[model samples]
Target chain A: MRLNLGLKTLSIFTALLLVAACETAPTETGDSSGGGATTQTSGSGSTTTVVTETKTTTVQPGSQEDLVLNVGDRVFFGFDKYDLSDEAQATLQRQAAWLKANPTVTLLIEGNCDERGTREYNLALGERRATAVKNYLVTLGVSADRLSTISYGKERPVALGHNEAAWAQNRRSVSVVN
Target chain B: MIGSVQKIRTLLAGLVLAIALASVARAELVIDITQGNIEPMPIAVTDFYADNEATAKIGKQMADVIRADLERSGLFVPIDPRAYLQQPKDLQVTPVFANWRKIAAQALSTGLVRALGDGQINVQFRLWDVFAEQYLTGIQFTTPPSNWRLTAHLIADAIYKRLTGEDGYFSTRVVYVSESGPADRRIKRLAIMDQDGENHQFLTSGNELVLTPRYSPTQQVLTYLSYFNNKPRVYLYNLDTGQQEILGEFPGMTFAPRFSPSGNQVVMSMAQDGNSEIYLMDLRTREMKRLTNHPGIDTAPSFSPDGTQITFESDRGGRQQIYIMDADGSNVRRISFGSGNYGTPVWSPRGDLIAFTKLTGGKFSIGVMRTDGSQERILTEGFHNEGPTWAPNGRVLMFFRQIPGKNDGRSDKVSLWSIDLTGYNEREVITPGDGSDPAWSPPYNLNR
Candidate 1:
C-alpha cells in the first residue's frame, strides 16, 4: 500500500513538472529581451545616458561590474551537484582574465540555492558551489587572496517563481567585485 | 486469638478512612487532560478590580494581555467579555458559581490590583473549578507597575499549571531574523520580541546581514551568524551590556551556530576548500575542537539536554540525513531513513524526540521522530516551511512558512507560525515584517 501511494505521488509530480516546463519555455526569451530594452532606453536618453555609462565604468563602491567584464558574473549548477560544468568553467575563465586585467580588484563569490530543500544543507551546498568556482578561478591564475566566498543558502533568490526555470536560475554562484 | 481479633478490627477501620479521603480528593475534578479533542477549553477571565482610580485603568490592561496570551496558545478559549453575566464587583464577594456555570464556562479566573505606593502594585488572582464547585489555586505578587504584563503572565502560568499539569511558556521571548526589502537585495537583522509579538526591538541595524540568533542558557547572550567586515563568522551579542565580539578567528566561513547546554562552549560549522564540518569552541579558554572530520557536509549540531550526546545533519550517507554521536565525537550512528532528506535536527528539551525539516517531492515539511528514527510523523507540509524550534515545554513548535511568488515573481511573504504537538492548533504569529529562523529562549527562571 505504501509503495502504491509513493508511485501515485511520483506520477503527479512528473505531470506538474511537464506543465511547468511548457509554461516557462516561452517566457525565458521574453525576459532577456525585456531586460535588454530597458538598458537600451537608458543608454539612449541624453541625460541618463551619461549617468549609466559612468556608473558602469567608474567602478564605484557597491556597483555591479558585470557589464564591464563583457561576461555574466554568475554560473548555474545542476540539482544538488557542485561540480563545475563546461559552461561554468568557461565563465570562470573569463572572470579570471577580467580579474587579472584589474589587478587591484577583489571579488566576493556568493553561493545560493533554490527553495526546494532544507535551509542548512542548502547553505552547505551553496558554500561548496561558491568554493568550486573560486578554486577554478585560482587554477586560471587568479590570486587566492583576492577571492572570498559566502553562501546565502535558499534565503536569496533572483527568481521568485516556483518552476524549473526559476530554480535553475536560483541555483548559482555570482562573483561581485569589491 | 482475642488479641488478634482486636488488631484486625483496628486495621479495617484505618483502611476505610484512607479510602474515604481518597474519594473526597478525587471529587475535585482532577481533569484527565492527557488526551482530548482539539477544541480549547472555554474559560472566562473577569476584569481585575483596582482599589484606586489610577490603578483601575491598569487593571483592565493587565486582563487584556493575559487574555491574549491564553488565546494565542490555542489551549484555552477566552469567552467574550460582553457575554459575562458578572461584573468586576462580583470578584470582591464570592463569585456566584451559578452565573458562570450558566455561560458553560469550565473554569473562571478573578483578580484584584492595589496600588502599594512607590510605583509598586500588588496583584492577586484566584482560579476556580466551576464544574467541581471548588477553588483550585490562588497567588499574589508585588512588583513595579511597569511589569504589569509579566504579573499577568504569572497568574496565567499558575492556572495553566494547576489545570493542565504542565508548565506554561507565556512569559518567554523569541529571537529571530527580521527581513525586509526584495528577494534579491534583502536586509536581515537580529530582532527580539515577546512570545506574543510585543515589545519588538532590533539588536542590530540593517547595515550587514545576520541570521540564526540563538540565546544562551546562562544569560542574555546570543550567538548568530553575521557578515561583518565581509567575513561570515559567528559572533556573540550580550543583551545586558550591549557588547558584541567574534567567537573565533577561523580561516574560513563559519555558520550554523548553537550554544551547548551548559553555555560554556559553542558548536558550529565551518567551510574550507568546498567542505563543511562541525567544530566546538570553549568560551572560557577559547580552545577549538574539530568534531567531524568528513569530506562531506556535516552541520547544524545540537546537544542533548544532558550535554552528553550531539545530534546533527550530514550528507555522508549519500543524502542528507540525521545522525547522532557522543559529545567527544564517537560512536556515530545514522538515525533517519525516511523517504526524503532531513536537516536541522533539534533535540527536544524533554530528550525524547528530535524535530527536523524534511524535503520530498518538491515540498518542504516539519516533522519529528524518536531518537532511534522510529515512529516518524510529519506535522506540517507546505510549499516552503522549515526551521522548527520547540517551545520550552516541548509541547509546541514554531517555524517559518514562505508563500510562493505570483506571476510577476514579487509577492513572496514569510511569516512565523506555530502548531501543537498533536498536529492541531496551527496558528500564524504576526510580526512587524517578514521573519524567519525563530529560536525560543529557555524559560525565564531556567536562565537564572
Candidate 2:
C-alpha cells in the first residue's frame, strides 16, 4: 500500500539525517559490557578491560560493521515491574564499563509498553521503567552526573507486526547511547 | 360512491401529513450528553468528618487538597464548599437529592471521621447519584491520622472509577527529583507522594543532586538518576523491603531507561563517545540488542503496544523530530512533519495514536496524531509545555507549565496541569512543591 511505502520513505529520509547528525556529535561513549549492568567499575574487580581489544565484543564506533543489535543485548521487565533482574544487572554492568572511559557520553532511556492498556497510563508506566534503570546505575557506583532519563509511554516503537514477538519487543527499556 | 372516494382521499392526505410531522421531529437537532464530562468525575466535597481538634487546627486545608485532587483529575469538580447544604454527613440518612440535582451535579460525595476501636481513625463517606436518587458507593477506611489526606484521595478515586469504566490515577504515587539553587549548585533529592499531591515524603536528602526517579511496573522498586560522585548513573529503591541496588556500570553516560511493556526488560538511551542509539536489555537473561543504528542522534525511543516497533526522537532531519522503526532496527522512518520540531513521542496503549511535544515558532505545545503522521491536532498551547504523560483513558494528558511572575526569579513558577483532547477543560493537576515532569501511572486497579 502507498501508506506503508510512504512510511518507509519518510523514516529512511529521517534516519539518514539522524545518522549524519550523530556522526558529528562526537563518539565518546564508554564501551558497554553488554545490556542491563553498565558499570565501568567492575563489581568484582577494578582492572579495566578494553572492550575494543575483543574486536568481536562491541561494534566499533563509526565502523562499517553492522550495528543492528542482536537480541543478546536487550533487557526485559516483568509484568508491570521495572526492577533490573540479575540478567539485566549484567547487561548494565557491561554498558557501565563502556561509559567510564568515554566521559563525554550522554543517553536517553525510553520507557515502553505492549498494547494492552490506555496510552496515558502506559506513558507514565514507561517513565517509571526508564527511571528504574537510571536509578539502578546510579547505585552501581556509576556517576549520576552523566545520565538523563525520559519516557515515551509507548508512543514510538521498533516492531510493526501484531503478535507475541512484537509484544515482547514492545515491552522493553531501550538505551540510546550518544 | 363519489362522496366515499372523496372522504378516503381526505383521510389519506391526513395520514401523509402526520408522517411528515413525525419525521421532522425526529430530524430536529439532538445533542448527545453521552460524551458527558470525562474530565475528573466532578463531585462536591464538603469538609471531611474530622476531630474538632483537627478541623480547628488546620482550618479547611485538608478539604481543599481533596477538592484539588478531584478537580486535577480533569474528571471531577468538587462543588464549591459554599454549596454545602446538609454537609457531607447529612447524606447517611438521606442526601437531599433535590439539593445536589439543582446544582447540575450528576454525583454527590461526603466524608466524616471518628476514632476507631483500634486507635486509628476510621474515615467514612458516601457517593450518591443525584439523578438515580441512591448511594452509588460508600465505605470506611481505617488509617493513622497522618494518613487522613491519603484516605480522602482514595475516596475520590473510588467515585471516579465507579462512574467511569476507567481506573482512577489518584491513589498512585509519583517520584521525581526536586531541584533548587543555581544550575550547577542545584540541590536535588528524591521525593515521593500520591498522584493527588498529598502524603509527600522525601526518599533521600538533597545533599547530592538527583536527576530522575522511576517506578517498577510490578513491584515497589524505584529507579532514578543521581550525581553522588560527579558521575551520573541509575539507582533503585524498594518500597516494601527497603532494598536498594545499582542497575549497571556503563563507562560514559547511561541516562534514560524504561521497562518493557511486560515489565521484563529495560530499554534506554546511551551515549558513548558521541554516538546516540536505542538499545534493549533483557532483565532475565541480560541480553542486549541495538534498536537504532543511524548516524543521526537517535534518543528518546519508546515502544509500540506490541513491542515490535519503537518511536523516538532524532536530529537526523536537521531538528529534533519523532521517528519509528522495526524492533530490530531494520526499517526506520520519521513521524513528525509539522511546522515545529517534535520530541517525546509516546504510543497510546490502544494502538491508535501517538502523543508528542511540538516546539513551533518558538512556542511549545502538546499534541496528538495518527501513527502514519496524519490527522495531527494540538491540544494545548502556552509559553511552554513539555513532558506530556497520559491519563489511563488517553482522553487527557498531564504536563507542566511555567510562567515567570516578574523579571526576578520570584516569577518563575512551575505547575502540573491536565487537559482534554477536545481542549475544552484545561486545569492544573496539583503537585506538592513546584512540580515538573509529571508521569501518569496506569489506572491503580490494585486492591487496598
lDDT of candidate 1 over B365-427, digit per residue (tens): 999999999999898998888899988888888999988656233467888999887677789
Predicted candidate 2 versus true structure: per-residue lDDT over B342-418, tens digit per residue: 87777776667888877776567888899999999888876667767666556667777765443222334666777
Q: What DockQ would you assign to candidate 1?
A: 0.29
Docking class of 1: acceptable
Error of 2 at B7 (Å): 73
Model 2: how far residue B17 lies from native, Å:
50
Q: Any idea what lDDT model 1 has?
A: 0.77
lDDT of each: 0.77, 0.57
DockQ by candidate, in order: 0.29, 0.02
TM-score of only chain B in every candidate structure: 0.92, 0.77
Regions more than 4 Å wrong, model 1: A1-26, A29-68, A97-105, B1-36, B407-409, B446-448
Question: Candidate 2: misplaced stretches above 4 Å?
Answer: A1-178, B1-43, B46-65, B87-90, B102-104, B110-114, B120-124, B140-146, B207-209, B239-244, B305-308, B326-330, B349-351, B402-415, B428-435
